[model samples]
Target chain A: MLELLIVSTLNGVLFGMLLFLMASGLTLIFSMMGVLNFAHASFYMLGAFFGFQISRWVGFWPALVVGPVLVGAIGAVVERFGLRNVHRHGHVPELLFTFGLAFVIEEVVQMIWGKSPVDFRVPEVLDFPAFTIFATNYPAYKLFMLLISIGIFVALFAVLTKTRIGLIVQASLTHPNMVAHLGHNVPLVFMLVFGLGSALAAIAGVIAGPALVTQSNMAALLGPILFVVVVVGGLGSLSGAFVASLLIGLLQTFAVSVNVSLADVFAVFGFTPGPDSMLDDLWRVTVAQIAPILPYLLLVLVLILKPSGLMGTRET
Target chain B: MKTTYVRGLAVAAALSLCSAASAQESIKIGYVDPLSGGGASIGEIGLKTFQFIAELQNAKGGVLGKKIEFVPYDNKLNPQESIVQVQKAIDAGIRIITQGNGSGAAAAITEFVAKYNERNPGKEVIYLNYAAVDPVLTNDKCNYWHFRWDANSEIKMEAITSYMKANASIKKVYLINQDYSFGQSVRADAKKMVSAKRPDVQIVGDELHPLMKITDFAPYIAKIKASGADSVITGNWGQDFALLLKAAADAGLQANWYTFYAGGAGGPTAIKQTGLNHRVFQISEGFANIPHAPAQEFEKALRAKYNVGLFYPRAVNQFGMLFAAMEQTKSADPKKIAAALEGMKFNVFSGGEGFMRKDDHQFFQPMYISSFGERGSGEPLDEEGTGWGWKLVGKIDTGSTMVSTTCKMQRPN
Candidate 1:
C-alpha cells in the first residue's frame, strides 16, 4: 500500500507537470487574446515534428533551442495574418479560425511526415536511471522533463509578475486602447504574446515528444484535456491552471490504482444486484476502467458548481 | 419504317457486346482501410502488400486471364466510413472487398456485405478480412460473405497459454490491455486459458486503459512493478503497444511480455530502443526472418521494392488462396469464388498446409511465437532497419491452434 501511494503520487505529479507545460500556453493565450487558441496543440505537434527533423540535422541539444523558435515564429505569423483578421468578426469567427487552422496544420504535417510516428528518442546523456523508489527505476529523461517543466513554470511566473514587458503584455490583455494611447505597440505586443504562448506549447512538445508517442493525432488526443485544465483552473489564471493540472493528473493516476467498484460499495450495504440486472455492467465497472473520463466528469461538475473554475476570477 | 427498326435493333446488339467486353477487362477488388489518417501508416502497408500480391498474380498470366486490380478506398479507420467506402466500391462494380485494421470496421464491413449480397442477388460481394483478430467475428457474429485470414484472439490466447503451460518458470502473470471488446476478450481468455492449463500460476493484475488515448503509461508500469508479475500479456497495438513498452523500459520493469502485435509496423524499432534483448515476444503467422528460403526471398524482394519488410504474411496467403480459388472456379464470379474458398486447404507463405474452416470461414495456420533481439546465426532478416530480429522460439501447428467455434453461418440460396 505504501509503495502504491508513493508511486501514484510521483506519477501523478509528473503527469500534472506535463499537462501544465501544455496548458500554460493555452492559459496565457486565453488571458490575453481570449481566443482559446485551438491550434495551440497543433503548434506543439509542429514543434515535435520540427524537433524530430532538426535533431536529425543537428543534435537534440541544438534542436531543442531551434525547433521552438521556428514554431514560435510560425505562431507569430499566424497571429498577424490569420487570427488577427478573424478577430474583427467577433469571438465565434476567431474560434472557428483557430479550429480550422488545427485541421490545416494536421494535414500539412501529414503531408510532410506521413501518418506514422517519427523516431524521436531521448538523448543518450539523459537515458540512464535517475533514481529508484520501491523497485521502480525512474529514467533520467523523465527527471529532465520534470525539471524543464518546473523551470518553465518558474520562468513564466517571474516574467509575468516581475518584468516590464510582462506588465505591458498584461496591461494589453484588458486595455489595448489605453496601452496604444500610451505609445506602446499594442498590436505587436498581442502578436508577441501569441507567439510566446505557442513557444511555451512548443517547449512542452520538444521535451515530451521523446517520452510520449509523438504521432500525428497527438494533438487531438491531448486537446480536450488541455481545455479541461484551463477551464477547471479558472480561465486566464496561470496558478489556477497549474493547480488544476495536478488535480486532474492525481485524480486519474490514483483512480487507476483503485480497484473498487459500485458492486463492492453496494455489497457493504447488504445489497447485491443479480447478474441479469439492467445495470449489472455498470455495477461491475471498477474505478480504474473509467479513469480516462474522470477529468471530463470533473469539468462538468466544476461548470455546474463553480462556473469560474477552482481558481478563475471570471466565469466563461 | 421496318428498315429503321432493323437498324435500331442492330445498334442495341452492338451495345450489349461492348458491355460484355468491359465486364471481362479486370477483376477489381476494393481495398478499404485507413489510407489517409492516423491508421494510414499500417493501412498503406496493407495496401502495398495486397498490390504486390496482385501484381505477382498478374505477372503469372493473371487470375483466369482477368487482371487483378486493387482499387484503394480510404476508410479513415472508421466503421461508418468503411461502410460508405464499401458502398462506393459496390457502385463501381467491385465484387471483392478487403479490410483488416480494426475489428469494429471488419464487423461493419462484414454485415454490410452480407446485407448487400442478400438484397442484391446477382451482384454479391465477398469481404476478406486480413488482420482483425476479434474472436466474436468468427463465432457469434460470423457471416457467409465474410472470411477471415488471421487467427482470432481466442485462438492466439490458447496458443500462448499452452506454450506458457510447458514453461515452468512463469509463476505470476499480469494482463494489461486496451479497454475495448478486443482487449477485453484477450484478458478474459488469457485468465481462463492460463488458469485451466497451469492452475499453479497466479494472475497478479488485470488492467484496461482507454484505447490509444494514453500518452503516459508510467503509472501502469509502476502498478505492474508493485504486483511482482514475471510475465505480461497485452493485445495493444499501434501507439498503445509502443508507449507501454517504452514506459516499461524507462522504469526498468523486468517482465517477459507476451503480445499479439509486438511485430506490428513500428514495433521492432520500439523494442530495439528498449534494448530488452529477447524479453519481448509476439505471436504471429509469420515474421520477417522466417528461415524458409521462399519466404525469405519474398521478404527480400518486398523490402527491395517498398523499403518495408512484409508485415502481413497472411496477406500473401489471402491473395494466394484468392488466386487459387479463382483458378479452381475458372471464373471471377463472387459466388463461385466463395464456394471454392470454403474448406479450402493451401500451402501458407511461411510454410505448413492450412485450411479455412467451413463452419466460420476462419483460416487456421501454424502460429509462431518469436522474441525480438540481436539476430542468431540462423535468423537472416531483421526488421525496420533494426539489427534485432524475431528469433522463433515456439511454433503451434494448425492442429494445435484450433479452437471450437459456435458459428452458424447463413448460406445464400
Candidate 2:
C-alpha cells in the first residue's frame, strides 16, 4: 500500500509540474488581458506539429527553439487580427473568437500536416531513465519535462520581478488606462505577453508531444483541463493557477494509478448483490476505475468550496 | 523494305487482339479517416497500402485502361465534419469509398451512402470498410450498398474464444471494455462464450467506460485485482489499450492470461505497455508477426513512402481486400465492382487468404496471436523505452464463416 501510494504520488507530482508549464502561460495571459485565451491549448498543438516538422529538416535542437518561435508568431498574428477584431464585442466575443479560431486552426493543421500521428521520438541524449521506483523506471524525457517547467517558472519569476518591462506589464495588468497614459505601448505589451504565453505553451507541447501521443486533438484534449485549471485556481491569480494546475494534475494522475471498486465497500458491510441486481456493476466500482472523472470532480468541489479559489484575488 | 516493315507492324498490331479481352473503365475512389489523430497510425498505414495497390494497378495500365485516382481526406475522427467531407467526395462523383474510423461516424455514413446509392444509381456509392468493426454494419443493420473490409465484432471474439479453448486454462473471466456499442457487444460476446464453452468459469467483473475519455483505471484495476480472475477479455484498442496495460500493471491486476480484439492489442503500443507491466499475448487476427513475401514487400514500399510501418493487422487486411476487389472488378463501374466483390475469392498473399462471406459481407480471415515481450531493464532510450514488441505464436482461423444473426439477410448475387 505504501509503495503504491509513493509511486502514485511521485507520478502525480511529475504530471502536475508538466501541467504547470501549460497553465502558467495561460494564467499570465488571463491576468494581463482580462479575457481567457480559449485557443491557448491550440497553440500548444501547433508547437508540437511544427516542432515535429522542423526536426525532420533541421533536427531536434533547432525544433526546440524554432517550434515555439513559430507558434509565438502565429499567436501574435492571431491576437492582432482575429482577437482584435472580436475584442470590440466584449469579453464573451473575445472568448467566442478564440473558440472559432480553435476550430479553424484544427482544420488548417490537418491540411498542412496531413492526417497521421508522427512517430515522434525524444532526442537520444535525453532518452534514458531519470529515476526508478518499485521496479518501474521513469524516463529521462518526462523528468526533463518536469525540469523544463520548473526552469520556465523560475525564468518567468525573474522576468516579472526583476525587469523594467516587467514593471510596465504589471502596471498594465492593474491599470491598462493608466499605463497607456504613462506612454506605455499597451498593445505591444499585450502582444509580447501573448507571444510569450503562447511560446511557453509551445515549449510544453514540444516536450509532451512524444509522451501524450500527438494528434490533431492533442490541444483540444488539454483545452478543458487547462480551462478547469485556470478557473479552479481563480481566474486572475498566477499563484492560484499554479496551485490549481498542480492539484488537478496530481489528482488525475493518482486517481488513475490505483483503483478499488464500490463492491469492496459493500462487501465490507456484508452486503452482497444478487445476480439480477442493477447494481451488480456498481458493486465493482473503484476509485481508479473512475480516474477520468476525478479532475472534474475536484474542479466542482473547488468551485463549491471556495469561489475565490486557492489564491485568487479576482472573482468571475 | 519500309513498305514491308509498315505492313508487318500493321499486321502485328491487328494480331495483338486475343481470346481474353481486358475490360476498361476509369474510376475515382476516396479514402477518409483521422489520419492525424491518436488513431493516425492505423489510418496512415491503410493509406500507404491503398497507394501501393493503386500504384500497382496503375502501372499495369490502370483500372480498365483508365487510371484509378484515389484522393484521401482527413476526418480527424469528427463525425459531423466527416459527413461534410464524404458529401464533398460524393458531389465530385466519387463512386467507391473506403473508410476506417469510429463506429458512430461509420454508422452515420451508412444512411448517407444508402441514400446516395438510391438517388444516383448511375454512380452507386459503394462503401468498403477497412477498420470499423460494429456488428450492426454486417448484421441486421447492414445495407446492400456497403461491404466490410474487416471482420465483425462477433467473428473476432469467436477467434479469441476458440483459441483460448485450445491454448490456455482460462477459468474466471473478467471483462473490461470502453463503454459503447462495440464495447458492449464485445462484453456480450465474452459472456456468451464463457457460458457456451466453459460455464464453470465464473465471471468475476465486467466494467465499461466512455470511449476516448478514460484517464485512469486504478479503481477498475483494484476491483480486478481483488476479483481473482484467471484471465481478462476486452475490446480496448489504440491509446485505451496502451493505457490499460500500464494501469493494470501499475495497479497490479495481472491475470494468468488476457485477450483483446484491437489493432493495438498485438501491436507496438501493447508491446510498450507490456514492457511497463508484464508478459502478454496481444491477441491479433492473422498469426504472422510479419506477413508473407508479398505483404513484406508491400510493407517495405509502404514504410519507404510513409516513414512508418503498419501497426494494426487490419490496416493491411483492409488494404489487401479492397485492392483485390478493385483489381478484379477491373471496371470502376460501381455496379460492376459490387458484382465482382460479391462472392469474391482471391488469395490475399498475407498468409491464409480468406474469402469474403457472401451472405454477410464479412471477411473470414485467420487471426494472429502475438505475445508482448517484457520491456528490457535499465533506462528507456527516450520514448522508445515504452516500445512494445510483439512475439508471434500459433495461428488459427475463427471459422471465417459469419453465421448471420438475422434470418432476413441474404447473399447478394
Candidate 3:
C-alpha cells in the first residue's frame, strides 16, 4: 500500500508537470492575446514530429534546441500573417482560425509522417532508471521530463513577473494604445509572446514525445485535457493552470489506483442494484474505470461553484 | 419490306451479343474499409493485401474465366459511411463486398447486406468479414449473407486462456483493456475463460481505460505493478497497446503480456524497444515467421513486392475458399458462392485443415500463439526492422479452437 501510494504520487506529479508544460504556454497566449489558440496542441505535435525528424538527422539534444525554434518561428509567422489578419475580425474569427488550423496541421502532419506512430526514442544517456522506490524503477527520461517541466515553469514565472519585457507584454494586452504611445511595438510584443508560448509547448513536445506515443492523433488526445486545465485553473492565469494541472493529475492518478465503486458503497448499506436495472452501470462502475473523466467532472464542479475559475481575475 | 425488318432484327441481336461479351470482362469485388483518416494505415495494408491476392489469382488465368478486380471504397471507418459505401457498391453492380477493421461498421454492413438481399432477391450481395472479431456477430447477429474469416474475440480468449492453463507460472493475472464494446467483450471473455480454465489463478485487477485517449499509461502501469500480477491479458490495439507496453517497460513492471494485437502496426517496434523478449505473447491465426515453407515463400514474395508483411494470412484463406467455391459452382453469382462456402473444408495457408462453420458462417482455423523476441537460427524474419521476430510457442488446432456458436440463420428458399 505504501509503495502504491508513493508510486502514484510520483506518477501524478510527473504527469501534472507534463500537463503544466503544455498548458502554461496556452495560458500565456490566452491571457496576453485573449484569443484561445486551439492549435496549441497541434504546435506541440509539430514539435514532436520535428524533434523526431531532426534527431534522426543529428541527435536528440540538437533536436531539443532546434525543433522548438523552428516550430516557434512557424508560430510567429502564423501570428504575423495569419492570426494578425484574423485578429482584426474579432475573437470569434481568431478562435475559428485556430480551430481550422488544428485540423489542417493534423492532416499535414499525417501526410508527412503517416498516421502510424514514429519511433521517437529517448536519448541513450537518459534511458536508465533514475531511482527505485520499493521495486518501481522510474525511468531517467521521466525524471528529465519532470526537471524540464519544472525548469520551464520557473523560467516562465520569472519572465512574466520579474522581467522588463514581461511588463511590456502584459501592458500590451490591456493598454495597447498606451504601450504603443510609449514607443513600444505592441503588435510585435504580441507576436513574440505568441511565438514564445508556442516554443514552450514545443519544448514540452520534444521532451514528452519519446515518453509518449508520437503520432498524428496525439494533439487531439491532449487538446481537450489542456483546455480542462486552463479553464479549471481559471483561464488566462498561469499559476491557476499550474495548480489545476497538478490537481487533475493527482485526481486521475489516485482515482485509477482505487478499485472501489458505488456498488461497494451500496454493499455497506446492504443493497445491490440488479443487472437489468437502469442504474446498474452507474452502480457497478469502479473509480479506476472512470479515472479519465474525473478531470472533466472537476471542471464541471469548479464552473458551477466559481464561474471565474479558481483564480481568474476576469470571467472567460 | 420483310427483308428490311429482318435486317433490323439481326442488327438488334448483334448489339445485345456485344453487350453480353463486355459484361463478362472482369469480376469486381467491392473492398469496403477505411481508406482515409486515422484507420487508413491499416486500411491501406488491407487493400494492398486483397489487391495482391487478386493479382496472384488473376495471374493463374483468373477465376471462372474472368480477372479478379478489387474496387476500393473509403468508408473512413464510420458505420454510416460504410452503409453508404456498400450502397454505392451495390448500385455499381458489385455482388461481393468485403470489410474488416471495425465491428460497429461490420454490424452495420451485415444488416445492410442482409436487408438488401432480402429486398432484392436475385441481385443478392454477400458480405465477407476479414478482421472484425466481435463474437456477437457470429452468435446473436449471424446471418446467411455474412461470412467472417477472422476468429471471433471469444475464440481468441478461449485460446489464450487454454494456453494459460498449461503455464503454471501465471498465478495472478491482470486484465486491462479499452473501455468500449470490443474492449469490454475482451475483458468479460478473458475473465470468464480464465476462471473456467484455471480456477486456481487469481484475477488481481480488472481495468478498462478509455480507448486511444490515454497519452501516458504510467498510472495504469503503477496500478498493475502494485497488484503483483505475473500475467496480463489485454485486447488493446494501436497506441493503447504500444503506450501500455512502453509504460510497463519504464516502470520496470515485469509480467508476461498476452495480447490479441501485439503484432499490429507499431506493435513489434514497441515490444522490441521494451526489450521484453518472448514475454509479450499474441494469439493470432498466422504470422510471418510460422515455420511453414510455402507460407514463408509467399511472405517473402509479398514483402519483396509491397514492402509489407503478410499481416492477414486469413485473407489468403478467404480468397482460397472464394476461388474454390467459384470453381465448384462454375459461376460468380453471390447465391451460388454463399451456398458453396457453407461448411466447406480446405487447407489453410499455415498448413492446417480448416472449415467454415455452417451455423454461423464463421471460419474455423488453427490459431498460433507467438512472442516477440530475437530470432533463432531457424527464424529468418523480423518485424518493422526491429531485429526481433515472433517465435511460435503454441499452436491450437482447428478442432480445439472451435467454440460453440448460437447462430440461427434463415436460408433462402
Candidate 4:
C-alpha cells in the first residue's frame, strides 16, 4: 500500500509539472489578451515535430533550445499580423480565429509529418532508470522533465515578480491604456508576452515529446485538458493553474489506482441491480473507468459553485 | 406517318444502346474509409492498395468486361460520417462498398448496407471488409450483404494462446488493449483462450485504455512492471500500439509482446528504438517476407508505385476473390457475384488454399506469426527504415484456425 501510494504520488507530481508548464502559458496569454488562444496546444505540437526534426540534424540538446525559439518567433509573427488585425473586431472573432488556426495547424502538420507517430526517443544520456521505488523503475527522462518544469517555474516567478519587465507586464495586464500614456510600447509588449507564452508551451512540448508520443493528434489530446487546468485554476492566475494541475494529476492517478465501482457504492445502500436492468451501465461504472472525466466533472462543479474560480480576482 | 414511326424507333434504339454501353464501361466500387484525420495514414495505404489492384485487373481486360473503378470517400473515422458516405456511394450507382480501418465505422457501414439492401430490393450492395476484426461482426451480427476478409479476433487469440501453451517460458502474462468493442473482444478472447489452453500461466494484469487517446503510457507501463508480467498480449493498433511500445522501450521493460498489429505504422521504428530484436511478435494473414515469387514481385511493384509497404495483404485477397467471382458469374450484378463467392475455395499467395465459409461469409487462410529482428538476406521490405524486418516464426493453417460462427444470415430470394 505504501509503495503504491509513493509511486502514484510521484507519477502525479511528474504529470502535474508537465500540465503546469502548459497551463502557465495559457493563463498568461488569457490574462494579457483577454482572448483564449485555442491554438496554444497546436504550437506545442509544432515544437515537438520541429524538435524531432532538429534533433535529427543537431541532436536533442540543441533542438530543445532552437525548437522553442522558432515556435516563439512564429507566435510573435502571428500575434503581430494575424491576431492584431482580428483584435479590433472583438474577442469572439479572436477566439474563433485561434480555434480555426488550430485546425489549420493540425492539417499542415499532418501534411508534412503524415498522420502517424514519430520515432521521438529519449536521448541516450537520460535513457536509463533514475531510481526504483517499490520495484518500479523511474526513467531519468521523467526526472529531467521534473527538473526542467521546476526551473521554468522558478525563472518565470523571479522574472515576473522581481524584474522591471515583470512589473511592466503586470501593470499592463490591469492598465494597458495607462502604461501606453506613460510612453510604453503597449503593442510591442503584447507581442512579446504572446511570444513568451508560446515559447513556454513550446518548452513543455519539446520536453514532453519523447516521453509522450509525438504524433499529429498530440495537440487535440492535450489541448482540452490544458484548458481545464487554466479554467479550474481560476482563469488568469498562474498560482491557480499550478494548483489545479497538481490537483487534477494526483486525483486522476490515485483514482486509477483505486478499483472501487458504483456497484460497490450501491451495495452499501443495500441495492443490487438485476442482470438485465437498465441501470447496468451506471452500476458498471468504476472510479478508474471515469478517472479521465474527473477533471471536467470538477470544472463543472467549480463553475457552478465558485464562478471566480479558486484563485481569480476577476469575475469569470 | 410510316416515315415518322421509323425515325422514332431508331432514336429509342440508339438511346437504349448508349445507356447500356455507359453502364458496361465501369463497375464502380465505393471505397469508404478514413482518408483524412488520425486514421488517414492506414486509410490512404488501403486506398492505394485497392487502386493498384483495380488497375492491375483493368489491365488484364477488366472484370466481366467492365473496368473496376474505385470511388474514394473520406469518413474521418466517424461512424455517422461513414453512413453518410455510404449513402453518397449508393446514390452514385455503386453496388460494392469496401472499408477497413475502424471497427466502429465498419459496423455502422455493415448495418446500414444490410438495411438499405433489405429496403431497396433491386438496388442491393455488398460490403467487403478487409481489416475490421471484431468477432461479433461475424458471429451474432453477421448480415448477408457483409463479408470480412481478415480473420476475427477470436481466431487470432486462439492461435496465440495455442502458441503460448506450447512455449513453457510464458509463465505470467498481461493483457493490455484499447477500451472499445474490438479491444474488449481481444481481452475477453485472450483471457478465455489462455485459461483454456495454458491454465498454468498466471494473468497478472489486464488493462484497457481509450483508443488513440493516450499520450503517455508511462503510468500504465509502471503498473505492468509492478505486476511482473513475463509477456503481454495486446490488440491495440495505430498510434496506441506505437506509443505503448515506445513507452515500454523508454522504461526498458523486457517482456515479449504478442500483438495483433506490432508491425503497424510507426511500430518498426519503436521496435528498433527499443532494440528488442525478435521479442515483438504480430499475427496477420500475410506479411512481406513470405517466400513466394509472385507475392514478392507484387510487393516490389506496390512499393515502386506507392512508396508504401504491403501492411495488409487481406485487401489484395479481397480484390482477388471479387475478381474471380466476377469472372465466374460473368456479370456485374451483386447478387450473382455474391452467390459465386459463397463456398469459394482458391489458392492464396502464400502457397496455401483459402476458403470462404458460406455459413457466415468469413474468409479463412493461412495466418502467420512474425517476429521483428535484423533483416536477413533476400528480405526486401522493412517498416520505418528500421532495417529490422518481420520474419515469419509460426504458421496456422486455414483448417486449424477455423471457428464455428453463430451467424443467421438472411438471404434475399
What is the lDDT of every predicted structure here?
A: 0.88, 0.70, 0.89, 0.87
Best by TM-score: 1
Q: Point out the worst 10-residue segment of candidate 3 chain A by lDDT.
A: A307-316
Off by over 4 Å in 1: B1-25, B36-38
lDDT of 1 by residue, A154-220 (tens): 9989998899998998899878899999999998998998898888788888888888867788888
lDDT of 2 by residue, A173-238 (tens): 889999999999998898888888899899988887766656677777788898888888888677
**Model 4 collision count:** 0
State residue B386's C-alpha deviation in candidate 4, in Å. 2.8
Please provide, for model 1 over B21-116, each residue's C-alpha lDDT reduced to its tens digit, 9 standing for 90 to 100.
Answer: 867778889999887645667888888888888888888888888888999998877889999999999888888998888888888898888888
Better of 1 and 4 by lDDT: 1
DockQ of 3: 0.50
Q: After superposition, how far is residue A55 of candidate 4 from its true place, in Å?
A: 4.2
Residue A20 miss distance in model 2 (angstroms)? 2.3
In terms of lDDT, model 4 sits at 0.87
- C-alpha TM-score for every candidate: 0.95, 0.76, 0.93, 0.91
lDDT (Cα, 0-100) at B115 in candidate 2: 76
Scored by DockQ, the top model is 1
Candidate ranking (DockQ, best to worst): 1, 3, 4, 2
Docking level for model 3: medium
**lDDT by residue for model 2 over B154-220, one digit each (tens)?**
7767767766776456777888887767788888988897778777778887777667654344345
Q: Which scores better on TM-score, 1 or 4?
A: 1
State how far residue B104 of model 2 sits from its true place (Å).
2.9
Give candidate 4's TM-score.
0.91
